[model samples]
Target chain A: MSENLPFLVIAAPLFGALVASLVGWARPRYCYAIAMVSLAAGLTAAIALLVKVSGTVSGYEYRLGGWPPPIGIQHWVDPLSALILVVITAVAFLAVMSARANLQLELPGKERFVYPLMLLMVTGLSGMTLTGDAFNLYVLLEITSLSSYALVAIGRGRAAASCLNYIIMGTIGASFYLLGVGYLYLKTGSLNMIDLRQIMIAGDMHGSQTVITGFILITVGFWIKMGLYPLHGWLPNAYSFAPHAASNLMAPLMTKVSVYVSLRMMLSVFTPDFLAVHALWAQTALLVATIAIIAGSLIAYSQTDVKKLLCYLVVAEVGYMAGGMWLMNRAGITGTIYHIAADAFMTCCLFLGASGLIASTGSRHIRSFRGATRRMPWTFAAFLVGGLSMIGVPPTCGFFSKWFLIQGAIEGGAWHFVAALIFSSLINALIFFRIIELAYFKDVEHEDDVSHPPQVQRNEAPWGIRIPLFITSVVIVLLGVFSPRVINWIERFVDSVGVT
Target chain B: MSDVLTFIISRFNYWIYIVLMMIGLYAMIAKRNYVKKFIGMSIFQTAIILFYVSTGVKSGATIPILEHGHDIGHAAAAINPDHYANPLPHVLMLTAIVVGVATLGVALAVVQKVHDQYETIEEPEILFKLGQE
Candidate 1:
C-alpha cells in the first residue's frame, strides 16, 4: 500500500476527472461530488505518505512499470514532496467543497466541464510535486497549465483575453524550461534528477558552460511561471479575470507550486554547491526578489479591484519565498518551505472570502466593501485574519516565516533584503488597514447623513463556502503557533536532501 | 578565416536552431496581433522540437528499430548500442508535440472567444476598447 501511495495521489484524480466527465451531462452535481471524494482520498494518501516519510533519512522511490530509474520514470516520496502533497491535496479538497455553490450561481451550466478541469489540474500539480524525472516534470507542468487555461477561459467578458495572454506567456515559460532540460540531458546523458546530479558531480560538470546555461534558463523559466517582479505582468489580469471558483483554486496553488518546483530544483538538481560556486546567481536572485517585494506591494496598494489587489499580493508573497530560499542558509530554506504551506492556506482563505463577498454584495471594487463587516461577519472575519497574516502580524503563520527569513538574511549579511522585507510588511499593513477602514469606519462617518441609508443586514455566504474560509482561517493561526514544529520537520527534510 | 568557415559549416544546425528560435521569440514579444503571437509560439515550439531531434542525430547510424532475428540478451552476441540512433529525444519530442498541439488548440479557442467578445484580435485595440469601459 505504501508502495502505491504516490501513484494513488495522482491516478485517483486523473481517473476521477475521466469519470466525472463521463457522468457529467447526466448529472452535473455528481461531478462535484466525485471531485470532492477523489480529493479526500488523495488527502488521505498524502497524509499517510507524510507519516511514512517524516524523519526518515532514506526516502522511498516507486519506479514506473517496474523499470528502474535512469531507464524509466520514478516517483520520489521524500519528506518535502510528501508535505507538499498534503498541502496540495488538502487545500484542493476544500476548494472543491466550496465550489459547488459558486458553480451553481456564477457558472451555471458550466459544472460539466469545470469540476473535471479542476480535478485534472489537481492531478497535474500533484504529479509535478511527486515526479523525480525532469522531463516528466515538464509534462506535468503542461497538463496543469493546459487545464488551468481551459478553466480560465470559461468565464465571460475579458477572461478569454486574459487567458490568451496567459497561454502565450505560459508556453514561452514551458518551452524555456524544456530547453533547459534538453541542455541538462545533453551534458549528463540522463533525465532523472538523481541520475543527472550524480553524473554532473562525478564528471565535475558543475562549472561547465552547459550546466550554467541550463541553470539560468531553468531559473528564468520558473521565475516567469512564479510571476516574480518584472515577469509578473501576466498574473493579476489572468487571475482576476478567472471565474471565482477557478481563481480560488488557481491563484493559491499555481505560483506556490511553481515556487516549490524551483526550490526543489535548486536543492536537488543543482545542489547548494552550485550556489557557492556561483555567488552571482544568489546575489542576482535576492536583488530581483527584493524588487518584487516592493513593486508587488506598491502596485497592490494602487488597485481598486479587490481580486486584482489579492493577485498582486500573491506576487509579493512569491518574492518572500524565493528570496528566503536563496539566502543560502538552513534558516532561510526552512522558512521558505514552511511559508509554502502557510501562504497556501492564507491565500485560500482570502480568495474564498473574496468570492463570497463578490457573490453576495455584487461588487468587485473596494468601495463596495463599505459596511461589509456588518453584512457578512464570518467572511469579513476570515478576510481580516488572512489580511493580518499577510501583514506579518504575530501569532499568524506569516509572521514566523518572515521571522525566519529575516534571521537568515541577517546572518548572510544581506541587509538590503532585510530592509525590503520590513518595508513590504509595512506596505502590506497600510493596504489591509485601509481596506479595514473602508469596511469598518466608513459607515460611522455616514451616520450624520440627513438621509441615513438602511442598515446593512446579515447575509453570510452559504455553509459550503463559509466552512472552508473558517477552516483555513483557523489553520493560519494553528500553523503559526506550531510553526516551530513545522520548521523542525522541514529541517529534517532539508537535511535528507543534504542541504544543511 | 578558414577555421571560422569550417566551424560554421560543422555547427550550422545549431546556428539554425538559434536563428529560428530568436525569430520566434521576437515575434512572440513584438507582434500585436493574437494570431501572429500564436504563430510565433508555434514556431518557438517547432524550433525546440528541431533542437531535440538534432540531439538524436548520430552520423552513419541507422534508425533505432532492431533488425529481425537479433539475439535476445545473450551475453556474447549483443547489438552495438552505437549502431542505432538515440531514440529518447524522438520519444520525448512526441510528447512535446502533443503538448504543443494541446496548447495551440486551446490558444486558438481563446483567440476566437476574445475576438468575439472584443471584436478585434490585436491586443492594443482591445485595450483601447477596455479603457473606454
Candidate 2:
C-alpha cells in the first residue's frame, strides 16, 4: 500500500477528472461525486504516506517505471511534500463540496464544465506536490494553469478577460521557470531535483554564474505565480471577477501551491549550504518579502470588494511564508510549513463565509454587510471567526503560525522582520475589524413606509456551504491547539535533511 | 578578452536565444490586446525551448541512438564527442512544447469568452467596463 501510494495519489485524480469530464456532459451531478471520491482517496493515501514516512529519518523516493536517478521521473514523499499534500487535498475536497451550491448560484449553465476543470486543477496541484523531476513540475504547473483559466472565465461578464490576463501572466511565469530549468540542465545535465542537488554538491558549480542566473530566473517566475508584491497585479481582478465557487476554490490554494513549489526549490534543490555560501540571495529574499508584506496589507486595506481584500491578504500571507523561508533556520522553516496549513484553513474559511454573504445579501462590497449579524447570525458568526483568525487573534490557528514566524525572525537576529510582522498584523486587524464592525454595528434603514417596518429574516446559507465553513473554522482553532505536534513533525523532517 | 569573445562567438545561439527572449518579453508587457499578449507568451515560451535545444548542441555531434555492439561509451569513442548534441535538453523540450501548446489553447479559449462577454479585447476597455460595474 505504501509503495503504491505515489501512483494512487496521481492516478486517482487523473482518472476521476477524465471520467468527470466525460460523464459531466450527460449527468452534471455525477461530477461532484466523482471529484469528491477521488480527492478523498487522495487525502487517505497522503495521510498514510505521511504516517509511514514520519518515523523514518531518511525520505522516501519512488521512481516511476523502476527507472533510477537522473533518467526517470520520481515522486519523493518527504516531510515537506507530505505536509503540503495534506493541505492541498484537504482544502480541495472541502472547496469542491462548498462549490456545489455556489456554482449553481453563480454559474448555472456552466456547471457541467466547472467540476471537471476543478478536478483537473486538483490533479495538477497534486502532481506538482508529488513530482521530483523539475521538467515534470513544469508540465503539471501548465495543467493547473489551463484548468484555472477555464474556471476563472466561468464568472459573469468581464471575468473572461481577467482569466485571459491570468493566462498571459501565468504563461510568462511558467516560461521563465522552464528557462531556469534549461540553464540548470545546461550546467548539471540532470532533471531530477535530488540528482541536481547532488551534482551541485559534488561539483564546483555552486558559485557558477549560470547557476546564479538560473536561480534568479526561477525565483522570479515563482514570485510571479505566488503573487508576490509588484507581480501581484493579476490576482485581485482575477479573484474578484471569478465566480464565487471558482474564487473560493482557486484563490486560497493556487498561490499557496506556487509558494510550496518555491519553498521546495529553495530548500530541497538549492539547500541551505548553497544559500549559506551565497548570503546575498538570502538578503534579496528578505528585502522582497518585507516589501510584499507592507504592500499586500496596505492594498488589502484599500479594497472595497470582499474577494479582492482576501486576495491581497493572500499576497501578505505569501510574504510571511517567504520571510520565514529567508530566515533559513529550523524555527523559520517549521513556521513556514505550519503557516501553509494554517493560512489554507483561514483563507478557505473567509472565502466560504464570503460566499455565504454574497448568496444571502447579493452583495460583495464590504459596506453592504450592514447589520448582517442581526439578520443571518450564523454566517455573520462564521465571518467573525474567520476575520478573527485573519487578524491573528489568540485561540485561532493564525496567531500560532505568526507566533512561530516572529520567533524565528527574532532568533535569526532579523528584528526588522519582526517589526514588519507586527505592522502587518496590526493592518490585518484593522482591515477585518472594519468589516466586522459594519456587520454588527451599522443601523438598518427601513425603505418601506413607516407603518410597515422592515422585518429581519433569519435566513442562513444552505447547509452545504455553511457546513464547510463551520468545519474549517473549527479546524482553525484545533490547529492552533495542536500546533506543537505539527511543529515537532516539521523539525524532525528538517533535521532529516541534515539541517540543524 | 579575445579568448572570451571567441568562446561567446562559438556559442552564438545563446546570444540569439537571449534576443528572442527579450523580444517576447517586451511584446508581452507592452501589448494591450489579449490575443497579442498570448502570442507574446507563446514566443516567450518558444524562446526557452530554443535555449534548451541550443544547450544540447555540439560542434559536430549526431543523434544519440546506440547501435548493436555499441553502448553510449563505445559510440562516444567512435564519434567526436563534441559533435553529438546533448539529448537531455531535447527530451525536456518535448515536454515543454506540449505544455506550451496546452497553455495556448486555454488562453485562446479565454480570449474567445472575453469577446463573448465584453465584445472587446482591449485591456483598458475591459477595465473600464469592470470599473463601471
Instruction: Pick the DockQ winner.
Output: 1
* Model 1: residues with Cα > 4 Å off, grouped in runs: A444-446, A449-454, B69-77
Candidate 1 clash pair list: none
Give the lDDT of residue A463 in candidate 2: 80
Error of 1 at A174 (Å): 0.6
What is the DockQ score of candidate 1, to 2 decimals?
0.90
Lowest summed lDDT over 10 consecutive residues: which window, candidate 1 chain A? A441-450
* Residue A310, candidate 1: C-alpha displacement in angstroms: 0.4
Q: Residues A287-322, candidate 2: write the lDDT tens digits.
A: 889889988999889999888888899889889988
Chain A TM-score relative to the true structure, per candidate: 0.98, 0.96
In order, the interface RMSDs are 0.7, 1.2
The fraction of reference interface contacts (C-alpha pairs within 8 A across chains A and B) present in each candidate is: 0.91, 1.00
Give the C-alpha miss distance for residue A313 in model 2, angstroms: 0.9
Q: Per-residue lDDT of A1-500 in model 1, one digit per residue for the tens? A: 77798899999899899999999979987898899888988999899889888646767898889899999999988878988889999889888888988887788889989999999999999999999999999999999999999999999778888898899889989999999999999999999999998999899999899989998899999999999999988899999999989999999899999999999998998989877888887899999999999999899999999999999999999999989889989888988998899999989989998988887877899887777778777788998999999989989999998999899999888898999899989999999899898887666246556386656677888788889989989989999998888888888878776666
How high is the CA lDDT of each candidate model?
Answer: 0.90, 0.84
Tens digits of per-residue lDDT for model 2 on B1-133? 9999999998899888888888888878898887888888888888888888887777667887655634465555566556566787888788788888878888888788878777888888887887898
